[model samples]
Target: MSKLKFFVFVLFMIISVSEIRSQIVINEIMYAPLDANNEWFEIYNNGITPVNLQNWKWKDATSTIRTITTQSIILSANSYLIICQDSNKLKIQFPGINGIISTNFMECPE
Candidate 1:
């Protein structure tokens, strides 16, 4: 009975850890941009399922934590999301770029 209980506990721990693992990844970052206030970072969803980004928090190496989005935003599987400090500046910098642009990150560390 004790051995069976230990086995069950181990199985439960494995399942719990897998479920808690995140599929979102930070793909790219423009930490030092030539244009002022043009800092941006790209996040990719590598999982098969879409993930909601509402209220998700992130912080740079030298910045405080900030919410990713106030509104409900879904990041589709195998898709990229760009979080920028200045949307207008990013658009002007990369005129032909595409994908979801979020202006939630107020500032990025240089």
Candidate 2:
């Protein structure tokens, strides 16, 4: 009975953590783009509530992490925000994209 209770507690904790993490998701990634300095990734909000992105972070496979210090980055439900290397290059490459966010998270290799 004690073992079962422990298992249930662990399960509950896992579910709660997952729920907290379900608000945001990586929607798209454009790695190795033909244009110079055009690497980017898009984040989408999966939850029904708007998520304020102040101090929210993005990390690569390495230990490097970049935080969004911009206040009021409130992502509405089912919306996308892109984290990009170069806005000018991306704009020249893809003209009609409406939601392009530029950041200095990582520089594209020459």
Candidate 3:
């Protein structure tokens, strides 16, 4: 095979492996402030089935874990859910957003 063809094959293999490994993937994260107090992370349901986030948790690089305990959240297949610091603030910033789905996370210990 040509060098270009070989490169494409390797890239395709890597991406296929990644997709297989990721059941529920973190699609986007807003670390820095979009405004003064807007911080959020988006999770994507990459699997074919819906996922229940009833007791799911998120942990940062520092191992700070926060569980979702407020309400039961179910994310459908090929859908996205944005977990935010303040859903109200997020809605205010993006007025066109029809609905906001979120839960409060406990403050991580320093």
Candidate 4:
């Protein structure tokens, strides 16, 4: 009887973890060497559905913000965005009905 209870508990934990994965899809990631001078990162969501960025995290050698809140952007499927400390250098890739995607780089401030 005890063995059967243990098997059921293990199965339940496995199923619970699997459900969480379907919600968030980390589509793409880019890392620029900051060398403690600057901190920046870009995370794209390629999920078929829109996900609220609230409570999501981006981490580096320095800090972590609880969320990415900029213009309340919503990334549609197959689209991408740039999240960085220096938005001035790289133009953010936003989705139009039809447009060419583009990006550039910023030299880290010394």
lDDT per prediction?
A: 0.78, 0.77, 0.73, 0.47
RMSD list, candidates in order? 4.4, 5.2, 8.5, 8.2
Tens digit of per-residue lDDT, candidate 4, span 50-75: 65553345433454333455234555
Task: List candidate 2 segments past 4 Å from native.
Answer: 1-18, 34-36, 106-110
- Please name the candidate that would achieve the greatest lDDT relative to the true structure: 1
Q: Write down the TM-score for model 1.
A: 0.73
**lDDT of the structure predicted as candidate 4:** 0.47
Error of 2 at 60 (Å): 1.9
Stronger candidate by TM-score (2 vs 4): 2
Q: Which ten residues in a row have the lowest lDDT in candidate 2?
A: 101-110
TM-score for each prediction?
0.73, 0.70, 0.66, 0.44
User: Which window of ten consecutive residues has the lowest lDDT sum in model 4?
Assistant: 97-106
Whichever of 1 and 2 has more TM-score, that candidate is 1
Alpha carbon lDDT of residue 68, candidate 3? 51
- The lDDT of model 3 is 0.73
Deviating ranges (above 4 Å) for candidate 3 = 1-21, 34-36, 107-110
Q: What C-alpha root-mean-square deviation, in Å, does candidate 3 show against the real structure?
A: 8.5
Candidate number that wins on TM-score, 1 or 4: 1
Residue 82 of model 3 has an lDDT of 80
